[model samples]
Target: MRQIGLVIKTEGNRAWVKMQKGASCGEEHCPLSSSLIDDSQDDFYTVCAINSVGAKSGDQVMVEVEDLFLLRTAFMIYILPILAGILSYALLNYFLKIPSLTYTGTFLSVGIIAILLKRADRKLNFPYRIVELGTASVCISCPLKNRNEQQKLKP
Candidate 1:
């Protein structure tokens, strides 16, 4: 998937971007509109992406997520549990002749797989890269000066 974001910080060829929400995602009803990153404290979420085009802070750019990675993630989330349950039932009921315990085994296997996948989630960081740069000069809240201004306004 592709997204438009502002480069909030750049270091060692990686850019920390704040992705735009709503129509900027090119979807009328985007599912990721409310998704937040690790350090999101405002309207937009931050992501560290590969700086393919050498984008700098305040530069608006386009970032693309790997489609294959998305497909693999979907399969793991949607299909793996079903497969585990079916295998559990087949082995427990058909091979072991324990009809009474088939459903229990299936449930247990699925639960175990879910726990494993949840733990695996931490290691999955799909690559996002800058594909194109936009002409926008700066973001609505940027240049570090705006952050300082907001701090002074607090009572």
Candidate 2:
């Protein structure tokens, strides 16, 4: 999915982008809505992404993040642990024949796996990439443009 953002900071080949609030495809039921990070205070969210488009600080750019990556990460972080706990509980109960030991084993295994995944995430890089540098013409067609125009018309 694509998002329009301002390059708030740049470091080497990466940029800290403050995401603008609006759907890239201008669809109310966009699939990316669930994955897109949002902030409540300023209607903007920040993310560090690869600067493949050579965007500089203060420049508006389009960033792309794979939907598959988001779904995979979510599955691993949320679903995998629950599955692991269930499997561990079943196995322990069958082998040890003790309900208490089964619960303990399940919890301990889930904790260890969660901690290891957290460490692994720190060592891995995100799947986001900068796709293009925004132009004045791009802003004219942006979804936020209509909102801005409506606000101006209000007063």
Candidate 3:
């Protein structure tokens, strides 16, 4: 999915981008809604994105994050633990013949798996990339357009 962000600052090969609020995807259960709302609240929260496109501070750019990556992340976070738990329970119950230890084994396996995954995630690179950099469009109802116009009139 594509989102617009303003380059707020630059350091070396990275640009800190302040993401702008955009129209929802119309999904009834959008997982990104909470993050999007929080990001829109203030420029305090910014993403340090790769500046491969040569985006400079004050530039408006389009950031593209793959939907496939998002889906995979969601599946890893939500489904992997349940699968691990079930497998642990089955192995403990059938192979070890310990029916009483099934729940304990399941919970322990899930916790261990989650901790390992969390650690692995820290080493993984983000799947999103900067696709383009361009001017912010002006429209009659665009709030950013008004802000830009005001900035232009200031000096």
Please, what are the lDDT tens digits per residue for candidate 3 over residues 1-155? 76566788888888877764332243224445445555454322356788889888888766667788768877887899999998899888887787677878888999998998889788866555567874545233332454555332110
Q: In candidate 1, what are the lDDT values of residues 1-155, reduced to their tens digit?
A: 66667788899889998864543444325555544532343445577899989998987777889888878998998899999998899889887787777888889999999999989998888799988884434333322323454432111
Q: Which has the higher lDDT value, candidate number 1 or candidate number 2? A: 2
By TM-score, is 1 or 3 better? 1
Q: Where is model 2 more than 4 Å wrong at Cα? A: 20-46, 135-155
TM-score versus the correct structure, for each prediction:
0.69, 0.66, 0.66
Clashing pairs in 1: none
In the range 43-135, model 2's lDDT, one tens digit per residue, is: 445789999988988887878899888678878888989999989998999999988888899999999889988898888666778999976
Q: Give each model's whole-structure lDDT.
A: 0.73, 0.74, 0.67
Instruction: Give the runs in model 1 whose Cα sits over 4 Å from its true position.
Output: 20-44, 135-155
Clashing pairs in 3: none
How does candidate 2 fare on TM-score? Answer: 0.66
Comparing 2 and 3 by lDDT, which wins? Answer: 2
Error of 3 at 115 (Å): 1.0
Please give the distance, in angstroms, between residue 45's alpha carbon in candidate 1 and its true position after superposition: 3.6
Q: List the residue pairs that clash in candidate 2.
A: none
